[model samples]
Target chain A: MREINVAAITSCVRQMCMDANYHLSPDMQARLFEAAETEQSPLGRQILEKLKENLEIAAADQIPICQDTGMAVVFVEVGQEVHLTGGDVSSAIQEGVRRGYQDGYLRKSIVRDPLTRVNTGDNTPAVIHYTIVPGEQVRITVAPKGFGSENKSRLFMLVPADGVDGVKKAVLQTVREAGPNACPPMAVGVGIGGNFEKCACLAKQALLIPTDQQSEDPQIRKLEQELLAEINKTGIGPAGLGGTVTALALHVKTYPTHIAGLPVAVNICCHVNRHETMVL
Target chain B: MDCRISTPFTKEKAAELHIGDMVYLTGTIYTARDAAHKRMMEAIRQGRPLPFDLHNSIIYYMGPTPARDGRPIGSAGPTTAGRMDAYAPTLLDLGETGMIGKGRRNEAVRQAVIRNGAVYFAAIGGAGALLSKAITSAEVVAYEDLGTEAVRKLTVQEFPVIVVMDSKGNDLYEIAASKYCTE
Candidate 1:
């Protein structure tokens, strides 16, 4: 069994937090550049230009791409064959989040309560999702979820009879209703099937896919393509100025569900979808 | 549509802007988000004077990340406007000329925009790092206890924003988005 030091995990998590905020993944950047090329609307193209410029500036300056530095959300893939030493893994992760937010100058956007909504000064106690895998390596991914696009996320429960067409319609409706609120030329992640919680998790997990890649299943790929086209036709344009390309990409993830229910969830991420992963 | 607004804006200057016009924001603007806005509104309700002169000023809905070395502010981008919709009318009535943020506003806020002669401008929602370049300086003005949510006075240069809703009751987002939204 491989032994991983808790201190190492803490350090890695802190670095991941800062790195995710400052850098736009190269795959995402490439897609945005490609979208700029094919975007028909002049306004949409202009928005893409500004977006690219923003990414460059953020990277060079070592600052967050957006003001809402986001709540720390960490996805951990721990190996069953690995034993953690030195400190508690959960506490270490939280400590990393606190340090990263303070040292990296990222914003502390998390609030203590939903109703009273008191601000948590250090953006501590990150929302962590863990999966134990059969390996000796541990992997961590940190995504700073901003409120703008997060506010537009939606989940729908459909009758199994509704099928693929229903899924398409639902995804389109979510983007349509979102309008400029989610920010235009958005990347959409669709989760089909699974239980309620699983479907929501799948939607967020789908966002982890590279922006340029298409779904492996031809049927899902076709659905993704169709949805992408339809959403752009909405002309919500860049910044909702009226444009041809309103959505940059449509990504879908699915799992089997109960006979009676077809669950669908849409997780919308803005142009600055910031995330990074590390293996140790 | 061609419209012009002067520096140290007035209620009348805000009245001329229509939805869809590209706006070049000059002069000083203040920043505040959930915490500060609530406090300011509470103060106003208690008949207390605001920390700064809100008359003819634009309030950017933002909670910027902390600054890195040699920088005035960190990735300083706009937050959702709707979150502040509940408290916006009060500021508008107090003579706010414009609002800078992204997303939709409630109907009441839209009406207030028209009635109060203020315009709502949409800044690129997540383009904070790039947007920070336009901010020359930033200093907290009030509600320091709230940390990042404190009210801040920001001096900006050529800050770019698009008018989403104007004083005349036009909404760019509604108009532009409706064209492509099929039932």
Candidate 2:
């Protein structure tokens, strides 16, 4: 069994949080450049150019790209043969978040209680999802999810009879409502065929897929292309100021659901979707 | 063409702005978001003096990240204005003339703008780092305990924003979307 120190995980998580906030992933940056080329509205095109420059400044200056900085959402894939040592996994992750936000000067947005609503001071208790896999290497992904677009996410439960068309309608409706509110030229993450919670999780996980990457499944790839084309055609454009390119990409992840139900979840990520991953 | 405007905007100056006009705001503006708004409203209910005077002032709905070493402020950008819609008309009634934020405001906010001769501006939402370049200085004027949500008095120079809603209730969101959105 390969033994790994929890300190290593903490250090990895800490750096990932800071890095994810400071830099826009290369794939996302390239896709935004591509969107700029096709955007019809002069204003929208200008906004895209400004976004790219802002990202560049953030990276060069070693500062956050956006003020929201977002809540840390970490995904951990642990190998079945590996064993955790040194400290408890959950606390270590939280420690990493605390140091990262505090040291890196990222915003601390978490509230201790939903009702009373007091800032936790340090962005902590990261939303963590874990899975066990076949090999010995552990993969950790840190995606700082800002609530602006997250607030616009939606989940729909449809009867089995409402198939692909239903999913399309639901996604389009959500995007329509989002308009400029969710920050256009957005990335759409669609999760299909799972139950309520599973579908929601799948939708978020789907966002981790690089904007330039396509699904391996031929059918899924076709659906992603169709959705991307249709969404861009909406002309919500960049910053929702009206343009030819509203969405840079669409990612779809599917899982089997019960015979009676079809669940679809759409997670909207703004142009500043920030995520970074490390394998240890 | 871009217009240069300063704070404590007069009714005439407010009326001069129209939907789609670009602006470079230079002067003093206050910052407040959800928490600070609630506190300000509560203070009003308690018959206490507000931390800052409301007359003819413009408020930017934002909660910026903490400043780094030597910088006066950090990445500061507008937050979703819809969340502040509930508290906006009250401030407008108090003679607050302008608001800076992103996203569409509700019917009430639109009507308040027209009725009170106020205007709303849209700062590019995700362009916080770029926007911060225009903010020359920042100081927490009230509710410092609110951390990033504190009410800050920011001195900005050539701060870029677009007129999203004018005093006459011409809304750029509605007009622009209708004009440009395709099937």
Candidate with top DockQ is: 2
Error of 2 at A58 (Å): 0.7
User: What are the per-residue Cα lDDT tens digits for candidate 1 across A1-280?
Assistant: 9999989888888998899888878888887888788876666677789988988898887888887777888999999999999988999999999999888998888778889877788898689999999999999999888778888999999998898889988998898778788877788889998999999999988888888788889999999888888887787877777777788777899999998999999999887777889999
Cα lDDT listed for each candidate: 0.85, 0.90
Question: Which regions of candidate 2 fall more than 4 Å away from where they truly are?
Answer: none
> What interface Cα RMSD is found for model 1?
1.9
DockQ of 1: 0.69
lDDT of 1 at B102: 90
Tens digits of per-residue lDDT for model 1, B1-183: 534444687766776677777777777899988878989989998999898898888999988888777878888888888989999988998888788999889998989887887889999877899999989899988988787888889988888888888888688877786655543
Question: Which pairs of residues clash in candidate 2, taking residues 3 or more apart in a chain or in different chains?
Answer: none
TM-score of every model? Answer: 0.96, 0.99
lDDT of 2 by residue, B1-183 (tens): 589998767888899999878899999999999999999999989998887888889999999888888888888878889999999999998989999998999999999998999999999888888888899999998999999999999999989998989999988888675556667
Docking class of 1: medium
Cα error of candidate 2 at position A42, Å: 0.9
Question: Where's the lowest-lDDT run of ten residues in candidate 2 chain A?
Answer: A233-242
Per-prediction DockQ: 0.69, 0.75
Report per-prediction Cα RMSD to one decimal: 1.7, 1.0
Interface RMSD of each: 1.9, 1.1
Candidate 2 C-alpha lDDT tens digits along A1-280: 9999999999999999999988989998899888878777888888888888888878887778889999899999999999999989989999999999998989999999989999999998799999999999999999999888999999999888888889889999998889888877788899998799999999998999998788999998998998888887777777777788888878999999999999999999998888999999
